[model samples]
Target: MLDYDREAARYDATRGGDARAEAAAEAVEELLPRQARVVVDVACGTGIVTARLRRPGRRVAGIDRSAGMARMAAARLPGGVVCGDAAARLPLLDGSADAVTMIWLLHLLDQADSAAVLAQAARALRPGGRLLTTVDKNHAAYHTGGDVAALLGPVRDAHTPPQSDALDRVLGVGSGLGLTMSGRTTFAGLGQGRSPRSWREVIPKSPWGRRMDAATLAELGSRLGDLPDQDHPRPDPVYTLIALVKQD
Candidate 1:
């Protein structure tokens, strides 16, 4: 994964920024219960979404592993942000949170780490509390079907773990922990859709790209370069979020 600390400064800009943040927060809010007074956002990079999650009666806190990310989050949330690892343990007390959110977090990890984060989120939720997370993240980015996806699809599928943030995978992980899927929602990734040229630059440096042989990488680059609208963004991808309710 890219160094989150180093990426902190440009994270929002490279991401969809405020527009995307608003869309995400709005979708999350739709599934979040009004009575969920205390919400903990795991891997809350820069707290952009966390800040938007706040309301008159809701208390929102953000936790991130990167010091640089936590620092930026702290600025937006004051004393409500902390530096912590979700794959290990969240700093929050067990059964204290009314809701827990893990937005855009799980796909970055292997299955074991992903399971650990889910278990931690389960451990932190009160009975009947909700855990919301993004699933099928790897697939979301490539939904703009065309030459770009055709060229990169096979490589991505081979590199991506079958259980990495898939809905079934997340449901299975949560099953043993008394968490079950209750609802789901989708939101547009506003500024995140990529162009042929962008994919050429991204695929080579991406985590999966490191596993790709030199010849394969060069071939993909050449094909992507040959595609039309090299600079035009494809249709934006829609991200899926699943809500799991802890058993009472």
Candidate 2:
């Protein structure tokens, strides 16, 4: 797994200012009840989503494994942010939160760990509380012809390409974890090689992005650009937002 601790400082500069990050935050916010007061953001890297959740009366706590990321999140969000692993049990009391949200975190885990984290999230939420999560839309792979090559090029420790059905299986892992598929949204960013300047801004902040240098970035741009533009399609690198309700 990529240790976000080393890249915490540059993380926001690389991703926080991007349109995709804003869209993901907006998707999470839409799923929240208008009057919802408390929320937990898991793997809340640098409070990208947590910072956006701040409102007059709402409270948002962000948790991550990287202390540096937590510090960054704390700096941006008024609510407390803590350093902790999502794969293990969460630090909060059982049934303490009104909602729990996970963003771009499911693909990082193997099947077993993914199920464990969802169960833990279910445990932490009060009965009928909401669980909002985002995962990569599997359908995008077929539409984007060069996705596999691009994946091998940049994303290191690449977990299995996420499937659309994975979230339902994850929710079904536990008996009481009844989830309602609230809705799904899609986002497509400039793929590798399409725009070097844009990719440069995004690459250095992520764990994989940190490994790429200017030269490699340029190469990616060239190679990816060489491919036909016809490959790009709506929601080429799409994501699905899942909303689940904890049942007693």
- What clash count does candidate 2 reach? 2
TM-score of 1: 0.93
Question: Number of clashing residue pairs in every model?
Answer: 0, 2
lDDT winner = 1
CA lDDT scores, all candidates in order: 0.90, 0.68
Model 1 Cα lDDT, one tens digit per residue, 47-141: 99999999898899999999999999999999999898899998878999999998999988888999999999999999999999999987977
Please provide, for model 2 over 1-248, each residue's C-alpha lDDT reduced to its tens digit, 9 standing for 90 to 100.
56788888787665525565677778877778777788999989888767888778988889988898888888887558888888798988999988998886776677778787887888898877888887644433423445434533434334234442365565566444665555565544323122323433444565554566767656655654554543433223556777777776
RMSD of each: 1.6, 6.4
Q: Write down the lDDT that model 1 would get.
A: 0.90
Off by over 4 Å in 2: 16-18, 137-165, 174-176, 187-236
RMSD (Cα, Å) of model 1: 1.6
Query: After aligning candidate 1 to the native by TM-score, how far in Å is the CA of 217 from where it should be?
Result: 2.7
**lDDT value for candidate 2?**
0.68
Report how far residue 230 has shifted in candidate 1, in Å.
1.5
